[model samples]
Target: MGIIWSVIFSGMSFYWAMGGRLGVRSLGGALYEMSLNPSPSFLAIVWLTGFIKLLGAALLIMLLVHRHNSKLDRKLFYTVKIAGAFLFLYGALNFITISLHAFNIVNYNLDHYATFWRLAFWEPYWMAGGIIYFLSAKRT
Candidate 1:
């Protein structure tokens, strides 16, 4: 599941890098506008992010397939733990902050389209990835 989450996110990034338009507006604000007319640097960053997501997926996969090798497992164990916590907290922070602003609980500035997607989809999706990463590591 963690691998799936990472792959899907990477796919989105790769697609955007290649000029795909779907869901781009959900980025909102400057990013959305920039994506529509993406500069070379922007495309490169998107592509790099896609590869980064693949790396995360690869790490999770390593935890699944490699066993009986105590040394490597120990390192992966800690790495995944840290990565999982980061993923969880990243999503949670965005979710909480977006909910606060979207609901008028706070008067923070956020793009409307971004708030909708982050609140309803992206942040939850990230949190789910974090959970799956934790579960995978636990099995390791």
Candidate 2:
């Protein structure tokens, strides 16, 4: 499930980086605007993000396939845990940040669509990925 999430999200980034416009508005605000006419740097950034997500998926794959070596397994466990922590914190922090904006506790430049997706879907999705990675790593 975590691998699926990472792949799907990464695909979107790849699509956008390749100038595919579908679902770009869901990004919202400056990001959506930039997607319409992305500069080279923005394209690079998008590609980097896609690669990062793929790295998450790849890490899980490594854990699953490379279990014969005990030393490698130990390192993989800690690495996956670190990745899980990153995903969990990324989601949780964004969720909290958006929630704060909703209540006017903080001021962010998010639009209605961005805020809606962040609160209702994206943030939770990332958190789910984190939990899934943690469980998968433990089981492996």
Best candidate, lDDT: 1
Regions more than 4 Å wrong, model 2: none
Alpha carbon deviation, residue 74, candidate 1 (Å): 0.6
Instruction: Write candidate 2's Cα lDDT for 30-125 as tens digits.
Output: 898888888999999999999999998998888778557888888889899888888888999989989998788998777888888778888898
lDDT agreement with native, every candidate: 0.86, 0.85
lDDT per residue (tens digit) for residues 37-135 in model 1: 888999999999999999999998888785688899889988988888888999999889878888899865457877898788888988988888877
Q: Count residue pairs with overlapping backbones in model 1.
A: 0
- Model 1: how far is 79 from its true place, Å? 0.8
Residue 120's lDDT in candidate 2:
89
Each prediction's TM-score against the native? Answer: 0.90, 0.91
Candidate 2 similarity to native, TM-score: 0.91
lDDT of 1 at 140: 38
